[model samples]
Target chain A: MAALVTVLDLSLGPLTGDNFVIYRSGLRWLVSDGHVCRAGEPIAFCNIGLRSSDGEIRSTAPFLREQTDFQLTLAAPMPGTLHQLPDASRGGWLDQLDRYQHWSESFIPGSLDITGGAGNQSRWRLIFSAGERMTELAEDRSGRLTGWRRIRRAWHGERSDHGTLASLGTCEQNGVFLGEQHDFSELLAASPGSLHVIHVGDENLVPAAAVLSDRMRRDAGANALLAADMTQAVLGGPVTPGPADWHYAGSALSALTRCPLSERYDLLSRQGLSPSVAVNAVVLSVNAEPKVILRHRKLGYRAYWHRFRVDTTGQAIRNWLNVSFEALSRTIDDIQTDLRELCKLLAERGVKHVLIMNALSTSGGESIFTYAPFSQALGDELPSVRMKELNLMLHDLAEETDIAIVDVDSIAAGLGAAAHLPDGVHQSGPMQDEVRGEILHILEQRDFFAPPRA
Target chain B: MLLELSLPLINPHMAHARVDSILVRPDKKIAIGQAILELTVDLSDQFPHDCPPVSYYRLCASEAAWLRHLAIAAGEKAAVGTLLATFSKTSDEAVENCASRALRTTVVGVTRQWQPW
Candidate 1:
C-alpha cells in the first residue's frame, strides 16, 4: 500500500518526563505479556496510513520496529518489515549536528529510511527513515547501542507531547497536525505490520538531559549548586513539553516503586490516600509477594498499626515506624527495636525470614516533587520533619535488624533523570520502577524471595 | 478462594495493612493471565464506618477481558474494600478508581481543614 509513509521525529524534542513512565509501564506490560524488553528502550507504534492534510506527515509510523536488541517487537501475530541501519560514527547529544548542520555540511541529522524490499519498495520515511527494510536486518545487533560515544545528554523539556496530554493536543490531533508536517504517529505507523529495526549512527537519541540527570544523580544531586543548575534548566528551558519530547513516567514510576516507605508514601498518596490505598509494586520473588500494608495512627496518635500476612514460610518486606517524639538518637533506637519486633512477628507467623531496608531521598530531581498536583489545595499533610522521622526510623531499624535497607539514597543519587523527584517527600513515578528493580536485585542477592519450583 | 486461572490477581498495599498477592487456596497457581476470577467487594457493607483506614488488596484478572477479582483488605478500621474495580486491557484503572472512591467515600466523615503552610 504505497509503502506506508512514516516520520521519526529526531529533532531533540523536549521530554515530558513520560518516557520513563512509558518505559516502566511498557516494561511491566511486556513482562506481564511474556515479552523480553528492557527499560529506556525507544518504542515505535503503528498508525493506519491515513493522513489528515494529505501532505508529508503520514498518519502512521514510518519506521518499523526491527528485531533489535534495544527495540522490542511491537507487532502482534505476524512479523513486520524490518530494517537494519548502518552503525553510528559517534554516539552523542544532537548538539553535534549544530556543528554539522548549518555550521557544517557533515551534520547528518539522526534519521533513517525504510524500504519494504530491495529497490522495488517505496521509501517509508522521507526525513528520518528514508528507505525501507534492508537484508542486513539481522546483521546488526540491538544491544550494540553500547557503541555510541554518548556526548553529554541535553534535557529538552519542550518538544515532547507525551508530557502535555492534558496541556496540549490529543494523540489523534497530533497524528493529523504533526502528520501533515512531521507527525510522530506516522513514523510509528509507517511500516505496516512489521518489525523494523533502524540502527542509530554516531548520534544517540538518549536525551542529553537524561545524561546530565545521570551525572548529577551519581553526584548525590543534593549539592545546592546542582539543584540550582537544574532549576535554571527547568526555567532556562529544556524542550517545552511538546510533540518532540518523550515522557519518562514509566521509568520514574518503576524507580519509585522500589522506594522505601519513607519516600514512597507520597507517591502512594497520589491515588488520593483515602486511608485504604492500592499501589502496584513489582514483587521481587517469583511467587513471593511483598507485604504491602496500610498503616494508620491510633486514637490520640499513640501508635500506628500495619497488618500483612507472611506466606507460611515466606518472609516479606515491611516498613515499621517509631511513634515517639524523642530525640533522633533515642527514637532511632526505638525504631530499630520496632523493626526487629516486626521481623520477629513475621518469623513467628511462618514467614521464612524478613529483610529490613532503610530508605532516604536523594537530592537530585527532588525539587519537582515539591508541588502536589493531585492535592486540591495542595495536600501539605506530610512535611519534611515527618518524612525525616520516617527515614530515621528506617535507618534505626536497619541497624537493629539484618534486612539492611539498600542505599536507595545513593542509587537514587546516581540515577539522574529517573530520580528527578518533584519533592523531598516523594520521587517521580518513573523512579519508583527503577527502585523496584533495585530492590529485586537485593532480594535475588539474599535468595529471600526465590522463584518457586515451576 | 478456589477459582480458575484467567484473572489478574492485584494486591495493592497502602500504609501498614499490606497483602501483596492472593493465590487461590488449593492450587499454587500464580494467578496470571487467565488464572484470575472476578471479585466484587462491597465497602458499604464490609465496614460500619465510611472509608476504612487500611488500603491494600491482591488482584487477579481474566486474560482476554481484563475481568479480575480484587481481594482487597484494609486491616485498619479506617479503610475497607468499599468499591469494585472492573478489569480492562492496557490500562488498569478500575482498581485505582475503586480505591479512590473507597477513600473519598470514607474521607467525608473526618473534618479535614486545609492549612496552606
Candidate 2:
C-alpha cells in the first residue's frame, strides 16, 4: 500500500488596487526544488509594478513613491516539499523587469507535495517590501533587499490596519531587527500577526537620544538654516569639494532632515491600502551612545557619528565637520537626561512602549581586583565601565518612564561573551536568536498587537 | 622573580592582534591597574557581520611589577602566545635567561575618539 500524496497548487492571491492593474516579473526562487519549506517561510520573490487599467494614470497610484524598487516575496502557506514550475522563470533581465508579465491570480508558479495530507491553505501568502533608494544609482537587483536604501520597509497580514515598529539602532540592533538575510525574514517569520517594520540605516548619522530628540524638535526654520549652513560649508569652505564630498554631504543632510519617529506609513494588505499611524514602538540600542558627540557650533544641533564612519567620509565633508562642529562630552548623567527628554516627547505623540537594548558590559578579559588606581569617574575613562554605568542609568530611567530595557548584558554573560559576543557589540547567530526571543517576549507582554483604541 | 606577559586569548575569534599603542616603557615600575599596552582585535574576516567587529582593549597590570624588557612595540602585530613584555619583582633585578611564568594582568576595553580637527 502506497501513502496518499496531496499536491497543493500555489497561486498569486488577491492583491487589489482601486484603479490599477498589478504586474510582476519572472519568479526568483529563494529555495531550491524539492526543498521542504515551513509554513510562513518565504519561498520565492518577484519585482512588481502597478499599471493604470484605463490608461489614465492618476497622481496617486499604489506604491507610487516606491515604484522604482517595489518587490513582493511569496510565503509558503503550508509545510511541504516545493516543486517549481518549468516556465515560472526565464532568467536574466526577464526576471529583473516587472513589466514582463501580468500578475494573474490563477497562475500557479509552484506546487507542494505533502506525503500524508495537506492543510487547508492553498493560496500563496504575499509579503510586500519596498525600499526608497538613497540614490537612484544605488540599484541592486541581485537579491532580496539588496540596495542602498535610506528608508526600507516591509509589511505582512490580512488585517485592515497594521502596527508599526521602527528600528533606529546601530549594527547591533540592525542584526536583531533586520535578521541574518539583511531582510526582515527572521522577525517576520516569528510574527504570525500583522506588523510593518521600518529600518533606517546608521551609516551617516546614529540615532542616539540627543540626536533623535534634536531631529524631532527641529522646526522648518531650523531645517532651512541647516540647509544654508551645509550649502555654504560645501561650496565656500577652504577645501575643494569633489563628487564624493557632494554625495556624502547630501546623504548626511538627508539623514539630518528626516525624523523616522514622526513618519507614517501606507501598508498594502488584503483590505487594500490603509494608513498606519506613526510607529507605536521604537527599539533603540544603548551601544549607539557615544562618550563624546559633535554639536554644530552655531546651529546648536547635535550630530553623533561613529569615528570610523566619519574618518571614511570625503575630505571636504570631514573638513566641514571639523570646522563647523564642536566636540561635546557626555557623562552618564547627560545620557540619562537626553533619554528622559526623548521619552517625554514620544509620550506626547501617544507612543508608550520604548524598548532599549542595553550594552554588553562584561569583556570576560577584565580581572580587576580593586578600583584604587583608576580614576574616580571610572565611566568617563573606561569603556566597559561606561557601558556598565549606562546600563545602570537605563534601569533607573525605566523606574520613572514607560520604557523597558532589553538585557543583552546579562544574556551575553550567561552564554559566555567570548564565543557569542566577540567584539562586545556584534553577536553570533545563536546569540541574535536569543535576543530576538527576548524582544518577542516583551512585545507579547505589553500587548503590542492589540487593536488601537478609537 | 621574573614574569612574562604573552598575549592571552582576549577574544575567541581573533587569530592575532595589532599593537595600537604602548603605554608603559622599559625599566618603568607599573602599579596594579596601570595600563601596559593597547591592542586592536579585528574579526572582519573570521566573522560575517555587515560592519567589521574591530575592538580596542588595554592590557593593565593586576600585580605591581617593574617592566624589564619590551618585546613588541607599537604598530607591530602579535600572535596569541607572542610575548609582549617581561617584568620583574624589583626594578634593578637582572632579567637575563630567567625562568618565567605568566604575568597576572587585566584586559580592559577602551575607546578611541577621533579628533582630526
Q: Best TM-score goes to which candidate? A: 2
The TM-score obtained for chain B by all candidates, in the order given, is 0.19, 0.90
By DockQ, who's the top model here?
2
Local accuracy of candidate 1 as per-residue lDDT tens digits, A1-454: 5875342212222111111111100110111222322222222321111112322322231222221112112222112223222221223422112122111112222333322322322222211111111223223222212222111001011111110000011111122112322222232333121111121111111111112122223323333343343234333442343221112221211222221111111110111112111121111110011111112222111111112111111111111122211111113334345445545543443334343323343222122222322243221222222234545666665565554454445545665523343222233434544543454455445554323334
**Per-prediction TM-score to the true structure, in the order listed:** 0.23, 0.92
Q: State the C-alpha lDDT per candidate.
A: 0.25, 0.82
- Determine which window of 10 residues in candidate 1 chain A has minimal summed lDDT: A161-170
* Candidate 1 i-RMS: 17.9
User: Model 1, stretches more than 4 Å misplaced?
Assistant: A1-330, A353-357, A361-396, A416-419, A449-454, B1-117
Number of the top candidate by lDDT?
Answer: 2
Model 2 docking tier (incorrect/acceptable/medium/high) = medium
